[model samples]
Target: MLATLLGLDHLVIAVRDLDAAAAEWRALGFTVSPRGLHSPHIGSANHTMMFGEDYLELLGVVAPQPHNEALRAFLSAREGLERAAFTTTDAAAGVAALRARGLAATGPVDFSRPVPLPDGGGAEARFTVFHFPREEAPAGLRVFACQHHTRDAVWVPTLQSHPNGVTRILSALVATEDPAGAAAHLARLIEGTARRDGAFHRVATGPGRADIAFAPRAAIAALARCAEEALPLEGGAGMVLPTRKPRPPALASGTAIIFEEAA
Candidate 1:
């Protein structure tokens, strides 16, 4: 009983200053959403960049607490891609499936936050999240399954358009100490298989069929066009974006986002 992959939900980049991070992304031609605060208990806030079905979340601590201590520690160390979230239609069932596969999983925790509507009204965007055990993930990255209760509240059409001409996230690159082992773990989690591509291990999924590449730490630097000294040894190293035209990759919040011409 392997867990099914329902495609990517959203990727999170944790930052110290939310406004500054949002501005940085805006300068890079992304249409960042207005800042939204999480529930008081969660003590976090975010600005989202919606890209049709998939999105990117720039998250920051609004008020720190014991619950968010891990997030705080991540921000304290550095700002970058911290989490890779996959979409799941039924988070509780997803958790159960993973547990049956002998994988450690926690939560189908329900949470919601108010989102402002275009007509000056507001709606609560609800979610049930299934979290993977930290030990199972490659270092510096957290993987989880997210089930959205109010999809309309988050994927507003106006937020999908970007000035940079980016249409979709084509792939994500993960740098790991053991690429083969990590790739195998990902394959099992997604209930899909992995294949070797040079020194990289690749997994493909969803309607868009985006690729997830697991590569050695040294190889990731070269692929991202960043110096080895600057890139983190583990976690999300880069993303492949299919754009209307060719554009240079941008390094934001310590992640390399490469842009490619759409077919």
Candidate 2:
């Protein structure tokens, strides 16, 4: 049985230089936040350029020439949005469902470690993640997710400063040639409904939850322009849902996110 997954969390845009890409986000009016170095575990270091509770994480290889294989593969794809993240209640069960669908999938990988605290003490923050193996999903549609041990309050500081009009992620705009097939496959794995709308496939879960719209070449190109800087990818390009409001200037090149909240 497929485990119950909650909603969307974050999205990743693969860039050539983390610093350069982060700079673009800063130029667009957000108080870009700190960088998190997740080494020895995820194989690459990333700096998050924050906006409200959501963020645009600039990820790159920081080690030797072409340092990490996974990072290299993502960067080599060249200039575009890379992956979309979904929130799940059970990472282990999510993995099992993907495998049952015949897609190459991996663990509810854990990220729990002790880090120095401000009080001169150490604390542990735990997390879980899962991903769709490259061999199975198309280059661009690779799906992965992360869940932190911290409460929504402790970890989501960006939300406090988020402007009034902004709300949670409504949906992601994914560009895939096989919209119908992708939607069908995803519907089986996720707790949502997928519908074919011309060349795009729109997928969404509960009300006020995340939605993903899969488009083709032209649409993808149109959305890529919204990115502060392109972070080439192996698959087609598109936008992640619930962009920061006043909307990042970088997103000017993409489609506007539309949705309504419960009264």
Candidate with maximal TM-score: 1
Q: Give the TM-score of candidate 1.
A: 0.93
Residue-level lDDT tens digits of model 1 in 137-249: 75456788889988999998888999998877878888887888877778776777788998888876566646778887678777667787666788777787888867777
- Of the candidates shown, which would achieve the greatest lDDT relative to the real structure? 1
Report the Cα lDDT for residue 24, model 2: 64
Clashing pairs in 2: 78-232, 79-231, 79-232, 80-231, 80-232, 140-235, 171-211, 172-211, 226-250
Separate clash counts for every candidate: 0, 9
Candidate 1 root-mean-square deviation in Å? 1.9
* Ten-residue stretch with the least lDDT total in model 2: 252-261
Cα-based TM-score, every candidate: 0.93, 0.72
lDDT of 2 by residue, 79-110 (tens): 44566666667778778887777877777787
Q: Which portions of model 2 miss their true places by more than 4 Å?
A: 49-55, 64-68, 100-104, 112-124, 152-154, 158-167, 220-236, 240-263
The positional error of residue 109 in candidate 2, measured at the CA in angstroms, is: 1.9
